[model samples]
Target: MYRKEFFVFEQGRPVSALIRNYERKDFPELIRIQQECFPPPFPSELWWNREQLDNHVSLFSEGALCVEVNGEIAGSMTGLLIDFHLDSPDHTWEEVTSNGYITNHNPNGNTLYVVDISISPSFRKLGLGKWLMSAMYDLVIYKGLTRLLGGGRMPGYYKYAHKMTPEEYIASLLDGQLKDPVITFLLHCGRTPIRAVANYLEDKDSCNYGTLMEWKNPFHQ
Candidate 1:
């Protein structure tokens, strides 16, 4: 693994790690992380499968990044170019990602669409996921994209699936009266949830629904 000292603050203390470009050698740990993080029917297998990961890396190498801690792959992120000008409202996750193959990446597109962002179970609470997102932001600025958008799985929704609509559940969490382990973390990282998308993925934990989230880069704006 390529190593470099990259540090970030966590609770007023400096933490050191290595953040770098994705490589085929990282696939073993990447797949392990994916298996530990996502649940059934979510297509987590493709998250780090050699063919799928290579498809994305070969298409836009710079769009993917990894975080290494203690000589292990702790986190990873992946995205592809998209054209927001031609976008329609409520696009399904399958449609956005070409049924999870990510074969629709447009090289000249103006928007950077995040396809995946995952941290290994062992690396949670270390601020690695947030750091991964920051790396993505750096790439977005470099790519000259106007904005970043993606469908975020609302894992919290499953618990109350039969009790409330996705919006109500999100509102309760947004109001700070309820807590959702996954969405709460993403919300804290500056991603804005725009609307809820049903059948966004086959994720049982999310009730097959995801929140369409966005982050507008003022630098690009």
Candidate 2:
């Protein structure tokens, strides 16, 4: 089990936070974080269940991570390894993640595919999400993976969908004309946009579109 302890200030008070591998005991908190992070209209049925959480720790424990702040679960991130082809990177989240079961995780695969990252509503803006992302980058380097990839949501796109196409909206994001809650954050986290994928998820806010993003491991050969 990987473990790291760090401190972040919340309200000018230093709070200790720990990042570690997921345990069966953390399942309920994980589900709660999912519900709090993604509420109604985002699809309640898509929340992580007991079965999928079990599969995560069993199949790829290294990719299942959780962050606790002051003894409370503040955020979590799930990932799976896969043999990604740069030439043909288009795929829905369900097809890539096995509907969140991650049963298809490839131990020898060269890419770490992020399945989800959820932070509790109360934990927002505390840098916990970035710590989780940084930990995944560390995992990629530690495992000799080539890159970290995921289909990032465009939750802020719906506001512009009436005036622009998905492509244009993404372009605007890149050009600094617009900013998407998910895409912008990914960009800030050192990921680059690969392309826009349609029907990537059942997200009304994104109009069922997702931005494929990647962060290459600088140490990988």
Candidate 3:
């Protein structure tokens, strides 16, 4: 399985952190991270379930990853391979991720589609998210995929929804007029915005909208 170690500083001290493939033993912690990451009005029912976690590791173990700090699970990322069409990339999270089960994962797909990345509240600002993202990019290159793509949540959109259109809000973000927790983080992680998608998810903060973002593989032909 994929594994790596990192040294992250917390409270002026370095801590041991590890990036590795998810196992059945990590299911409970993964679920807890989901709850902490997406609480209340975010839909508790949408949290990661046992079946989905099982499907993820069983179907594509390489895409299901977790990060541990001081031997405790800090965060995780799940992905599935798919043949994405840049010409027609408009799709909801459910459609692209098979309703979060990722049962439709294609081993021969040309793209690594990130299904979800959830980091625990306690681990925020420690650069764990970026580490997880970097691991995924490495997986893309190792598999010779064309790109790493996903529908990035626009959690900050709700604050300005009554005053701006989704497109305008995204434009402001791209223009450095506003910052989003998710979109901004993805941008800093080397992803480029493709477009804004409506009805992409059930997130109230995002007003059910998502931003389509992608990171191209320079080594791909």
lDDT of 3 at 103: 96
TM-score of 2: 0.96
lDDT of 3 at 71: 97
lDDT of 1 by residue, 1-221 (tens): 22346875657777678888888877787788888886666565455578878887788778778888756788888888888753465778778877556799999988889888888776786888887777777777777788788888887788898989999988988899788876888788888888888888888889998888777887875
Which candidate wins on lDDT? Answer: 3
> lDDT of each model, Cα atoms only?
0.79, 0.93, 0.95
**TM-score list, all predictions:** 0.86, 0.96, 0.96
> Which lDDT tens digits does candidate 2 get at residues 185-220?
998899998889999998888999999999999998
Model 2 Cα RMSD, 1 decimal: 1.3
- Given candidate 3, what's the lDDT at residue 112? 98
Task: Please identify which of the two predictions, 1 or 2, would achieve the higher lDDT against the true structure.
Answer: 2
Ranking by lDDT: 3, 2, 1
What TM-score number comes out for model 3?
0.96
Clash pairs (backbone) in predicted model 2: none
- Candidate 3 lDDT by residue in tens digits, 1-221: 79999899999899999999999999999999999988897778889999999999999999999999999999999999999997898999999999999999999999999999988998997999999999999999999999999999999999999999988998898899999998999999999989999999888899999999999999999
lDDT (C-alpha) at residue 54 in model 1: 81
